[model samples]
Target: MIKPTERRVGYGVAMGYGVTDLFGGGAFAIIGTWLLFFYTTYCGLTVLEASSIFAIARVIDAILSPIMGYITDNFGNTWLGRKFGRRRFFLLLSSPLMFLYALLWLTDMNYWYYLGTYLSIELLSAMVLVPWETLAAEMTNRYEERSRLAGVRMIFSQLGGFLAVSVPGLIMQFTGKDNPFTYTLTGLIFSCVFCLAVFTTWRCTWEAKDVQPEHKFKAEVQRSSGLFNHLKYLILDLISSFRIRAFRLHIIIYIASFTAMDVFGAVFTYYVIYCLGKDAAAVSAWSSVGAFAAIPGTYAFMMLLNKLNLTPSSALRLAYSSIFFVLAFLFIVYYTKTPVPDMVFFGLFILNGVARAGLIYIPWNIYSFIPDIDEMVTQQRREGIFAGVMVLTRKSTVAIAILIIGMVLEEAGFVKGNGIQPESALYAIVTLMTLGTAVLLAISFYVTYPFKLTRETHKVLLKEIARRKLGGKAEDCDAPTRLVIKQLTGYEYDEVWGGEATRRVVGQVNCSRVE
Candidate 1:
């Protein structure tokens, strides 16, 4: 049974995670929605140049995420009789760095300075984000609870996106200006929000108890094994993660789904402003509705997951299919001159929001369960490897998707400041790409159905861990199973717990002839 204190700590940790996500997502949305326009129209860079810069930055960040993951997993500090751990340390340090770098947006830099500043800020953001994500998996071991945590974090993340998208419009409306100074003022406001997020995350949460002295000691011992050994271990873990058939399938599906989602998000504002000829106020109104809609949709999906006992694959398939069908219908309506009712459009927007909620929340929740399954197989909790590789995959997809979307726009004759193209063509390109990607995502989701580890299977694995002394005390049983219980059911073990029970729990058994 979990204690009240532990629950409180988890809640606090989740809140910190939410805030961090808010800061990151909000900042990115501001950049994605407006920065491109600023570059092409205001700063006078070609569309290709700006797109190339963004793509290269994302690719570099993708490469860096795994490296950061490795560093965090291996090198951590011991504090207050427990390991302060890599995740929290990096989070604390990077918060301020992220804030400082985000202020780069306010500068009036030429092309070279702009490119360099953007790349530098993006790299720093990834350093903060990669490890921050790993912390979420570390914080809990429960499946349903992980979903709840992810749901909460995602809601805040959307709120961040909402602010990022809506704030610029609000600022422009209030100040009665559309100049560079307006953008600078908006960046300053975002910087303040980033600082607030950092402080809350730093002070509000407790480090997980599992991050203790023994884990730190084990990590140290591994360090002495040399660099080649460490590389070998990483490679083996990567291979083993893929060998799990379900995990491999899940990775593929996640790549497809997330790539589509990221591409859509990056381009959605462009579509609204250029293709629909809508202003910031219209975009903000629709975006707010979409963001708020996700809250109820997320809770509904969670309830559906429980009631239906659906696997991640099943949930994803259902959600993706719904998104595709709705988008397709909307496209047809627009193309056929049927004049889709405003109410119908709003409903579709809500559907899109619901689809997005599931797409974002379920995959991470599923991944949180993978470490336990891996531990059951390898007899080691390699949470870092699992989190790292997943980060690598997701980031790589984002990079590739950005590149692809840029190329697609170039091919479709999308020129900066050309004004909206023929309505039919715009509809054809945007809707076909979005809906096509969704269809592929559905296929990938279906392909992953065979790999899912059901709740029953997970229970068996947990029992196996107990039997093999992977998680609990041999003295607690007389079945010769060699089970090692490191702490009481409701207590967390640390250096301060220096009693005989602790010793026995750590497998200090003596074998001598009976006298």
Candidate 2:
């Protein structure tokens, strides 16, 4: 068992936390690699029909995400929850069910039946994912520790993604794309991997038994006299959360960029098959080998995090800029319809793999810090609400992306199961994979650029939160506290609002104005 240590975790414990990413990595990688292709080509559905089912399911899931978040946030505090652990119990319950995830790929039932299966899987994800995501916050409070955890998770995420891409490719190399057995065997393999990963995470990781002492007031605020009262409180709390400036910016950046990434995953098969005109083995090799780059890339990211001392937000922006150039070049290569040397093709993907490390890992690391910022402003760490909204944004945009991709595919004149696609259709696929990412990521960057929180800012926020929890007066506050106070209020008061300092210094000359 990984021993519990406060605010700092050993490698064994961090691995337990990150290993669960394998579930998402394997499950989604399979889905991302094959679902759209399976639904259209294998099942003989129209692109619109196939895409619409997933889109509508996501819309339903979007509505359910916040409710799941609320459930996850409070469930662990219950009598049964405290013993087994809220997040841990849900994960344990979901582990075996992960095996059933293969059933999604196994069927091509009537439309309603298919929809039901998809929705069922989506709901199951909400149950496990919302809770699982909150684990890091419970596991450790240190910023660097959280970053380390995200890095470890990325390594495994890339591993799962590699399985999704390469395993199928390897299978197809022998079995050929003409065989339906390829997808079935692929699903079975990936789903089993997914199941074991979630189970391992549940069995190995530790959850915090004692609540953070700073959260007492926030916990009290959670109590309600009736169902209606509780809901009213929930509504009010949700509304209040959106009012935070930093979070609002994160939402914009997160939704746009993440949607683009999701769409890229959805469309990659088409780019490989329709655009590149590669066989199955080649498709899988490029996808899987590219992901291997992410492992080394993750190693590089962690090194940079410690060595460069760049804040996660700053690092994300810088790394993303490099990706923009790479995407631009890839777009040019594909648009020209020129046959590039094999070496160049491999090299481009390798560079993309490096960039993927930052793209995939930085946002999550940044999210761990958001709770700290919320704690500073609200004096409550509401990670569940934030986690809920993060998934909500993602699910909602997924719905939009599927619909748009479906309609766009139809407009591009893509013919299902046709060995050769029209140039127009190929162009659209390449554009969606490259230029679309470039444009959307630029928008994501604009929103992220204004993000005000940094390690320095966060350290200040943590200090203030601890001091407030201890009932320390403003007069006893440190420089960072005084700086924050000056920004919120025009002048720093000598005394805190309810605390016992009589000398209310109205600051004839203030030094703490945030520069």
Give RMSD to native, each candidate. 7.7, 5.8
lDDT of 2 at 467: 69
Q: Kindly provide the TM-score of model 2 when superposed on the true structure, using C-alpha atoms.
A: 0.89
Give the TM-score comparing model 1 with the true structure, all chains together: 0.80
TM-score, one value per model: 0.80, 0.89
State how far residue 33 of model 1 sits from its true place (Å).
Answer: 3.4
Cα lDDT of model 2 by residue, 1-515, tens digit? 34343656667877887888887666777777778888787776789888988899888887787777777667776987888886688888888887667677664566676677778878878877887887787787787788788788888888887777888878886788677778888777767777888888888776665654533222223254778865765566566566555677777777777777777777878887777777666667777777888888887887777667776667778767877877787677777877888788788778877887777777777777776655554445567778788878888887988889889988999998898989888888887878777778888777666676666666676667676666555567768667654333223434333211111211112222111
Which window of ten consecutive residues has the lowest lDDT sum in model 1?
Answer: 487-496
lDDT of 2: 0.72
List residue ranges in candidate 2 displaced over 4 A. Answer: 1-7, 212-223, 475-515
lDDT of 1 by residue, 311-411 (tens): 66678777887778765764566456565556666777778878777877777667767666554333345566666677777766676666666666667
- Clash number for every model? 5, 0
Clashing pairs for model 1 are 246-451, 472-484, 472-485, 473-484, 473-485
Model 1 stretches with alpha carbons more than 4 Å out: 1-13, 77-83, 104-108, 176-182, 208-240, 306-308, 422-428, 470-515
